[model samples]
Target chain A: MRATLMYGPGDVRVETVADPKLHEPTDAIVRVVQACVCGSDLHPYHSMDATTDGVPMGHEFIGVIEETGTEVSSLANGTLVIGTFSFQDNTCVFCRDGFQTACVNGGFFGSHDVPGAQAEYVRVPFAEGSLVPVPDVSELSDLIPSLLTLSDVYLTGYHGAHMGRVEKGTTVTVIGDGAVGLSAVLASRELGAEQIILMGRHTDRTDLGKEFGATDIVAERGDEGVAKVMDLTDGEGSHVVIEAVGHMPAYEQAYGVIRPGGIISRVGVPQYEKAPVGFGSIFGKNAAVTGGPAPVRAYIDDAIPLVLEGKINPGRVFDQSVALDQVADAYTKMDSREALKVLVKP
Target chain B: MRATLMYGPGDVRVETVADPKLHEPTDAIVRVVQACVCGSDLHPYHSMDATTDGVPMGHEFIGVIEETGTEVSSLANGTLVIGTFSFQDNTCVFCRDGFQTACVNGGFFGSHDVPGAQAEYVRVPFAEGSLVPVPDVSELSDLIPSLLTLSDVYLTGYHGAHMGRVEKGTTVTVIGDGAVGLSAVLASRELGAEQIILMGRHTDRTDLGKEFGATDIVAERGDEGVAKVMDLTDGEGSHVVIEAVGHMPAYEQAYGVIRPGGIISRVGVPQYEKAPVGFGSIFGKNAAVTGGPAPVRAYIDDAIPLVLEGKINPGRVFDQSVALDQVADAYTKMDSREALKVLVKP
Candidate 1:
């Protein structure tokens, strides 16, 4: 089976690898149909150490079940499905409470131990709880791109908005112009935010953000960006600030543009371990900070119907696509900002 | 007028100060009836720089209206009232949204310009918005202590419980054995929390916490405390952790005892300017951090009824009393931990 592997920073390869096998009774073998590079992948791409045995790469994908372990009762072979980036036994206490990302029996894919989805065949653990069967969309294959986003990005954006308590009449400011940020603009709009402000320097991405329901855009960064957003919001900051860029500057912007008594929801995986949360930031303003690795599994069931009904087209984030053999170029294109996201066909 | 003044670290004085005069059309002069030393006052007491002129101290009080400026309409002379530590024009947008502490025109008492409440007379700005009138409690004088707590401590605890979303079936862990932590225990019980774990080393305070509805008490700190809490919760952690202590260790303890997807509500005035909010603390757990200065004015109306009906007795936190001339001793007692809290009569 051909799979994507990263031997070190700036190194990606599509090489023949042993096919994934069901290692547990709760596992299922998935034949990958579509997968994509994630912004988070850039973290390792920029600094991952050289290794003899490369680590499997990619967590998001939509596939068909090629085989199922004996105990996997709910799913059958050949069934089309989408799974969360992290596999969980959805019946766990945390999962039942809508926090499947923290499921006790769960673990993320694409790690050294778990073969990733960007491959010919991937093994999915906790099969019944991890995979959500999808209606056959062979005739409407265009929906595949959008549905694939539910595996991570789109639902991550939804998690940001949901955690921020975005709702009717809320003024939201989203920091970052990545696929996740754009998805947040769409999610905020879906959640009925009255005003969506996208803070991004890229006109191309900001333009898409506008189309996705951003009522305003600030191309500046730092103090200038915060001033622009405050000016747009009548000197009061937005009710909710969604941070989709995993960096210190973006997190700072989140606090800067968050209204007093409002919320700062961060879906961005932080690049640093420390941030200001004292009287000067959150305490004195009576604001709140929330968001994390999204409970995408909890939202996938609902988001699928919206995508099917044409309520959203999150797939627009995928501006480029490549075959398995061109996987290295896909990483290069995204890392160099030539593509918003690159979908890979296996 | 006799007032309490902080000359420097470890130096408190009971001095005669000029009578407070109306400085704004919205101001009202209140003759102090009962003002209490607060846990926060210890901050300035421990590190304040020496000065020729001491700073007025104290922010919690219940009193009788001495006089009112022309614009003060809702409150009348001789009417007993309780006001939030921070005066706010309750008509402001933030105030209307139940965040009076962040009101645009609001300013806290006990600051350089605003006179503190531990005086014979204090001038309150935004009188109509800041003061909540109380029914004559002369016949039921015993309720005065409890009612006075509405101005700060008790309401601050309520803010913690409210921000943490404590409700029926919630498992709560309150850190700190101070007045606010005890108040949080009471608040959580009132809010229908099924399990209340009070983490404190002081048996006297923890006993009070138990009386206030703490079902369990962990007299440990740091890792041992975290271990004890986890053991009590069957290793899942509490649904909400109310941080009533503002130090980094307390904040760390909050993260330590929080369940995945839980909330860490902080009413403690943070002594530090930064804390860990990276994946290791908040993100990985899908938890939220919220709470600030209590919008006491917003809850005063609702809380007054609870006190009047004898449903709560927050004033029990005040275990000692001092006359106007003995105000200096009050601060010393609270500072030395010889008294949980001291009530000053001026």
Candidate 2:
């Protein structure tokens, strides 16, 4: 099987790898139909050390179940499915509470023991619990790109909106311009936010954000960005602030732009080891701060219908597509800002 | 007018201060019937320096309106009322949004210009907005002590529950056993929580907590305390964790006990300037951290009715009482933990 592997920093290659097998009765063999380079993939791509072993990559994918183990009862071969970034047993107390990302027996796809999604085939554990089948993939064929996003990005954006308590008449300020941030803009609008403000400096992304229901844009960063959003909100700040960037400064921007009694939902994977959440930071305004890895499986059931019905088009975030052999070019293009997101065909 | 004044660290005196008079058209002069020394008072009570001027102390009080300025329309002379820790116009954007504590024109009770509640008389700014009048005080005379608590502690507790999203059937863990923590136990019950856990080491306070509706009490500290709570919730953690202690360890305990997707509402005045809010700390669990100075005024209307009807007895937290000349003794008893709280009569 041909798969994308990361050798070291600034080194990526498409190489033939051993095929995955069903080692457990609960597992299923999935033939990858479509996969994409994710933002988090850049973490190891930019910093893989000298002695690091080549690692297979890609966590987001849509596929067809090529084979199913004896214990996998719900799914069958040829079932069209969307596997979330992480696999879950879906019966743990946490998963039952809709926090599948924290499931007791969950595992991520590109782990050392698991084959990555940017390949011809991958083995899925807890197959029935880990997969959400598209009811009629052929009927919804044209919505594949949008449906693929539910595997990670769009679901994450929806999580941000949901966490921030975005709803009808809510004034929302999204503090990022990346694909997730743009997806959050769409999610906020879908949640019926009265005013959607996108804070980013990129003309290309901001233009897309406007099309996605961003009523206003603030290109400034840090304090300046906070000031611009506050000015637009008549100095009271937005009712719901969605923090799509997970760095300290992004968190600071969110704290500064949230109105008293408002919520700041952060979805970006945090980069810092510690952040101040003391009286002066969050307690003074009676604000709320929450966010984490999206439980995409929990959300897929509700979000897929929206995509299938054409109520939202978060798939537009993918601006370029490349063959599996061109994964390196896709990375280079995304890292250099030449493309919003790159879709890969296996 | 006789008032409690802080001249230096460990130096409290009963001094004759100028009687309060209406200063603004929206002001009202009130004769305090009851006042209490707050936990926050200890901050300055133990740290006043040689260069520091004498500052009047209390902020919690129930009183009778003595006079009203020309523009004060709603409150009449002799009206029995509860004055919140801070005074606000109640018309600012923040106040309109139910965050009266951050109102544009609001000010605390113990400021240089405003007389503290420990004084015989206080000139309350924005009288119509700052005071919640008790309907037919004579009929509810026996409930005065509990009504007095609405000014701060009880309201603060309610704020914690509300911020943590306490609702029917919620499992709540209160991280302190102080008056506020016990009040949170009571507030959690009022908010319809099914199982309430109080985490503290003090037998006396925990007894009070159980009386206030604590279903369980965990006396451990640090990781042990977290483990105890996790054990209580089937190793998943509580649905709403209310942090009533204002220090770093208390915050850490809150983070440890909150279930994934749970809320941590902290109302304790923070002792530190910065606390960690990183990925390892909060993001991975998808938990929420929120709270601040309680919007006591916003909750007064609903809470007061319950207190007035003798349905809740938060004033039991006031375990000691002192006359005007014995203000120093009241401080000593409360500071030494001999009393959960102290009521002062001026």
Candidate 3:
């Protein structure tokens, strides 16, 4: 079997690896239809932190079930499935409360012992919990874009919006233009946000933001950007703000755009630096900020239905796709900001 | 008219001062029937910041309206009233949203040009918005206690509960057992909290807390206190926590008792320092923390009505009273913890 392995920094390679067999009864094998690089993937890509050697690299994938273990009843061989990057037991106390990522026995694919999905065939554990089988598609190509997005970006974006309580008539401000930010704009629109402000510097991404329900865009950064957002919202600021970037600037920007007693749902994966924020931003303004990692499986059931029903086309953000062998090229394109999201065919 | 004036730390004096008259159309001249030493008043008394210029010190009072300006129609001359320590227009956006303390024109009396109520007569501004008239007074003696608690402690405690979202069947934890903290136990009970945990070391306060509806008491401090609270909460923590101590340790204790997605409504004045917090505590825990100096005016109307109807008896917390001539003794007794509340008659 051919699998993509990351030996070290910038060392992504397609190599012959052992075929994965059913190691656990709850595990199933899936033939990858499409997988993609994530914005979080950039952390390891550019990080100085050493990772597990001879590691499988990608996480986001939509695939067809190739084999099922004895305990896997939900996923059948040949059924198409969109697998959440993070797996969880859906009935755990935390999962039942919509915090699946923190499930008592939950695990993140590709990071721990679980092999990732950036291969022709990959092992998927807890198939019933991780895999959501989509409807049969007449054409396989049309499935790639929607399937790719459903894995992580759409659910993560939805997490941001959901945490912020973005409802109908809400004024929303998004603080990032990456894949997750664009997905949040779409999710906010889906939630019926009357006004969506996208703050970023890139014209292409900003345009994509507008297409996904951004009524206004603030190209400035930092204090200037917050001012522009405030001006656009009649000086009261947005009722809901989706903070997709976890850095200091993004935190401040999120705080700046939320009105008193408003909400800031931050889904940005914080790295080394703790965001520097004072009482003025979080307490004095009386904003409620919430969100950690998205409970993707908690959302995939509902989000998948929306995709299968064609009610929301999150695939609009996907700009390109390439053969799985060209994963390195896709990374460069995404890293260079040349593509919003690139789908990789395996 | 004679007023209680602070010459310095432990140097309160009763002396003749110019009688206050109508200062604005929104003002009324009140003959102070009773005034009380606030928990916050002891702060300046105990601190190095203690002033010595004979400043009048009390902000909490029950009084008879002696004169009214042209625009002061809500309270007639001779009407008994419980007035908020802070004056607000009540028509500003913040006041409409029920945060009268943050009102555009809101101003604290006894601090700025507005004189303290520890006098025979003092000017009350925004009279219509400031005073809540009491119609029934069969227990006129309760007036001093009711009036004493109304302006500061009771409202502050209610503010804590309100910020914590104290509602029917919710479990609430209160950190601090000063007068306001004990008052919060009462407020939480009135709000229908199913289980209440009061953190206090003193047996007297814990007994008062239990009477005020505290189902559990944690006598330990710091981590031990948190452990005690957790032991009582079945390991999940409470749905709401009220912080009434205004110290960093209390802030930390407040956060410790609340569950993920819980609320910590702080009503303490944040005396030690600006509480150090950031996006992580808020976003990661999915908690909603909202509080400030209590908007006494926002709640005074309902509270005063309750007091007048005998539905609430904040007077139980008042341990003693004295004439304005004994202002120095009042301060000394309160500073020595000899009285929970000291009501002074003018």
Q: What DockQ does each candidate score versus the true complex, computed on alpha carbons?
A: 0.89, 0.77, 0.30
Q: Which wins on TM-score, candidate 1 or candidate 3? A: 1
The global C-alpha lDDT for each of the candidates, from Candidate 1 onward, is 0.91, 0.88, 0.78
Error of 1 at A310 (Å): 1.3
Ranking by TM-score: 1, 2, 3
Q: 2 or 3, which is superior by TM-score?
A: 2
lDDT of 1 by residue, A52-160 (tens): 8998999999988899999988887888899789999999899999999999999899876788888888899999999988956652388999999999999999999
For each prediction in turn, the share of the native Cα contacts (below 8 Å between chains A and B) that it retains comes to 0.88, 0.88, 0.18
Off by over 4 Å in 2: A47-51, B46-50, B138-140
Which docking category, incorrect, acceptable, medium or high, applies to candidate 1?
Answer: high
lDDT of 2 at A109: 85
Complex DockQ, candidate 3 = 0.30
TM-score of chain B of 3: 0.93
Per-residue alpha-carbon lDDT of model 3 for B1-346, expressed as tens digits? 8887765556667888778878789998888888888877776676635465666667788788889999877777888877787878888776786767756677776653787888888788888888777745532664557655888889889988987789999899999888888999999999999999999887876787888899999899899998989889887778888988777788788767677667788776665433434434444455656666777877876787677677778777777788888877777877776776777887
**CA shift of A307, model 2, Å:** 1.6
Model 1 achieves a DockQ score of 0.89
Task: Candidate 1: list runs displaced more than 4 Å.
Answer: none
Which pairs of residues collide in candidate 2?
none
